[model samples]
Target: MRRLAPLILWALACSAAAAADVSGRVSTAADGVNVVPLAEGSVIEVVLTTSGGEQVRTFAARDGAFALAGVPAGRHVVSAYNSRFVFPEVHVDVTASGVQAAALVFNGAPIPASPLVIRPAGVAQYYEARKAVDVVGFIKTPYGLMIAFSVFAMVVMPMMKVDPEEYREAMSSLRGGDGGGAVEQSGGGGRSGGGGARSGGGMQPTGAGAQRRQIRDR
Candidate 1:
């Protein structure tokens, strides 16, 4: 039993060292080379998916560092997530020796010299920004100017006061004179009896001329 005790102890030690710990940092790149850690109040979630579809999750600390302890020896994919930035998945291989992390893959292209430092490919925009209305710019447009003129006429025309009689007189004067002037000229010609009497005599053919012609024929 004493000889077998050393063998059992060695087996337990080997089993304990079989599982390794995976550690990495979450960072953001401004120019695609140098990386900076995430903000202090930011929450970053790191996920490790094993080859057998098992997942191990952990949150990054304030300094953007995270660790998953006792990960089984196998191949796994590491991904980091945040609300404002997009990150790429990293491939990692775990053995009894140590953890080996692959370079980050962004947009299907692997970044060179990139190790466990996870950086964002781009910023995530959830909503569009609201723009202010430009009053001057709108008024400069043809449609906007037309709308403004119509509104001005609507507002100002109601406030103006004008007498109906005065409006009618002014309109008649502007139209060359009062409408009664034409009627008055016709009445004056009738009263004068010069042109009116000649026109009446020419229109009546069965009067004195017709009677004289009948007497001569007899």
Candidate 2:
């Protein structure tokens, strides 16, 4: 029995280290008011990612309030979603002794939940129905597609190659100038005048006097 004393203390320490609690209220904006509590059945899911792996739990709010106990201590992302709304993910750190609190506010209404069904189905029909429902769900929503496309464009568009000549022509058209006409004319005149004058030893721009004149002109 004396040998068991050390094991008992280690067990108690592990239990304490794994203990955590989270609580929150779910609310929505009301007319002329800051916020109004949501109805019961709003679902809150907390996802904990630790060195051990990821753990998930779901809790339903009662009268807009919810509490989840026995969560493992670490950092977690809490996401609240329901038939009417979706809240942004909230980040919280869970300590052994304190409760992590959250206030979730949702702006836009989400797709309504399907009605409950109790009818039995064959194996093939069950899979077919589930696949159809999932496809419909993906098609009926625009947010996921929009976010994916936006991210894809931001990442891939920069890596795509654009023809320099095409870009120059487009800019010239926008500026009411011919593609290479303006560039050729201006560059030729500037080079000839600057190069000839400098080579003829008439106030070469390599000296301090030319710099003073340029600064005064600016």
Candidate 3:
């Protein structure tokens, strides 16, 4: 019975030590030093890879902090992502006592005492989601295309109108002159009328000419 008691006590201690926590805060690094919490109502998820299998835990951040309890102790790779962007992977060697402090930053700053792992999954998922959003936002549906075309017509189409100088030259060429064909015809008519008036005056014999001929006969 004494030997059995010692064995049981050792087993319980081992069990308790093996079950440790992995917890941390998620933040955005600004100016490489200032830290800001993620947007309100955003989703936070952590992916932990263990020898047994991959474990995923998702939770809403409260005051920009998250905690995973009872994480199996081992060498685990931690990958975290949100609806908008993903943080770089954090690698931690989980021992009998677990990783109690972990910080994931999106700002590309160095974290002290934290193993930074290369991103293999979170970045791919983030880009895929962003691509899906861009596709839907631009040309995924008829309405989206319609909106795009409408914007083009309203903003860009007006800029494509004929140039003012080119337009004036085209109209002048079509009319055959700068003042148009009508002005040419009107000017020709005025010249012809002047010639006719001079001829008519000569044919009528002016009064001065008649008076001079009568005085010469006297």
Q: Listing every candidate in turn, what is its Cα RMSD in Å to the true structure after a full C-alpha superposition?
A: 13.2, 30.3, 11.4
Task: In candidate 3, list every pair of residues with a backbone clash.
Answer: none
lDDT of 3 by residue, 53-150 (tens): 77847563654456667777776666766665556776566665656333343443435433222232222242333433476656868888898899
Cα-based TM-score, every candidate: 0.47, 0.35, 0.40
Assess candidate 1 and give its TM-score to the true structure. 0.47
Q: Summarize candidate 2's per-residue lDDT along 34-65 as a digit string, tens digits.
A: 54444464443434344356665555544445
Ranking by lDDT: 1, 3, 2
Q: 1 or 3: which has the higher lDDT? A: 1
Local lDDT at 192 for model 3: 100
Preferred candidate (lDDT higher): 1 or 2: 1
Residue pairs with clashing backbones, model 1: none
For candidate 2, the TM-score is 0.35
Over 98-192, each residue of candidate 1 has an lDDT whose tens digit, in order, gives 57546554444443322367767788779899989999999999999999999989997765767888888889889877567988998897788
Regions of candidate 1 where Cα sits further than 4 Å from its true position: 1-15, 33-40, 105-115, 128-218
Q: How far is candidate 2 from the true structure (C-alpha RMSD, Å)?
A: 30.3
Which lDDT values do the candidates have, in the order given? 0.78, 0.55, 0.64
